[model samples]
Target: MTTSHKQAPAFRPDWAFLMRHPAHLLAFGFGSGLARKAPGTWGTLVAYPLFFLLLALGAGPLLISLLCVPLFVLGVWACQKTGDALGVHDYGGIVWDEVVAMLLVLAWAPAGWAGWLLAFALFRLFDIVKPWPIGWFDRRVHGGFGVMLDDIIAAGFALAVQALLASWLPV
Candidate 1:
């Protein structure tokens, strides 16, 4: 039989397209978001190393929290611009929101890899599952605020779960 080849599906705003704008470059997590699969998860993984570096630099919870505010605020606008360029709101490849939200999670996470692992797992779970008000906002809200809120809400849930785990799990 003759060999048959499968064509790969195209991903949007490929690096060249996103590279035209700095905002898109960042909102795309410096290209981590460009992954053909599970972009958001890749973006979160990108955030992990950065957070570890910050921790190494002795960035305590307060400083990390302080840093997140601006990222969250700026991400709103950056995401909007990138979305407009991509012709889709909150495109899977647009993951600055995940980056900032991860920062928020890490800011409050405990002082070791175990805690970091827990936070990452919890954040990803809540983000993907989108329970309760998170789902509500995801459905009802639109645009940049909408894009960011669900993750923020997910972070809230993750924080709560982390708190509960801290109380009981002794990890």
Candidate 2:
């Protein structure tokens, strides 16, 4: 069998395609998927939350969460593009959902690193386990809102578990 040499697939930043729509830029966190596709992982990571969080920090955490919704909408759109580019469904790096869910969990639990760690573990567990409706949504849903919904559901499960565990254990 003759083997043909193939070049390594290079990462392409889809600036032109992205620039056609401005909403995605506004949605930095959620659009990290698109950013991930364009800048790859590192570029997306640095830029994803930096400018928005900075511009948003002045408004306070509550306002920041509120602002994230629009960003989320746009991010979902961006995720669609990224998914197409990479030819995968729900790439791990495109984690705007995780960010949003994590913050929302914090909003509910209201504690220090302990709570954050619990939340992180629980969210990841539920998300990976994909229990019940979270799994259903993750499989059935498509596009941006769909992408965000399953993680939100997973976060809900995570939040509930953390709350119960926190109350019971009292750590």
Candidate 3:
């Protein structure tokens, strides 16, 4: 006997789709999420400067880490609104999850451009590969929580990788 699974409809949100609401605008990462290819990568790239801005303001790791709670909350709401508008949960073009995930990874990442770069690569790797728990959440969860949970798991993985490398790798 063969089991068949139905796939969710694919959607490629355009610029106008993001313009419909403020949440959509943010969830789309100010249009970076609208990229025809690798929208998540683009969204992650957009996160770097924002992270730097907070660091530049003298926000310590603790502050940055604490910010994750509110950011995740906002991200959930934004993702929910945008997902509802798009009629898809965790749409590829909805990239606020990537943006927030970068923040979580960087919150624990070592200081310096090299550290940030490594964190970025690892986060993207796990986000794309979705191993173990991340894949489980991505498959089992739905709605806004589902959208953000997998990326948050990926960030946790990236954080561990970054910590492991920081002790051994020279920057």
Compare the candidates by lDDT and give the number of the best one.
3
- Per-residue lDDT tens digits for candidate 3, residues 1-171, read 111122332456777777878899999989998897899999998888888899899988789888878988998999888777767777787889999989888878888778888999999999999999899889888777788889999999998888889876556
Which stretches of candidate 1 lie above 4 Å from their native place?
A: 1-11, 168-171
Candidate 2 Cα errors over 4 Å, as ranges: 1-65, 168-171
Reference-based lDDT, each prediction: 0.82, 0.57, 0.84
Model 1 is weakest, by summed lDDT over 10 consecutive residues, at 1-10
lDDT tens readout by residue for model 2, 99-118: 66655555555345566567
Residue pairs with backbone atoms closer than 3 Å in model 1 (clashes): none
Looking at model 3, the pairs that clash are: none
**TM-scores for every candidate against the unseen true structure:** 0.89, 0.61, 0.91
lDDT of 2 at 117: 60
- Between candidates 1 and 2, the lDDT winner: 1
The TM-score between candidate 3 and the true structure equals 0.91
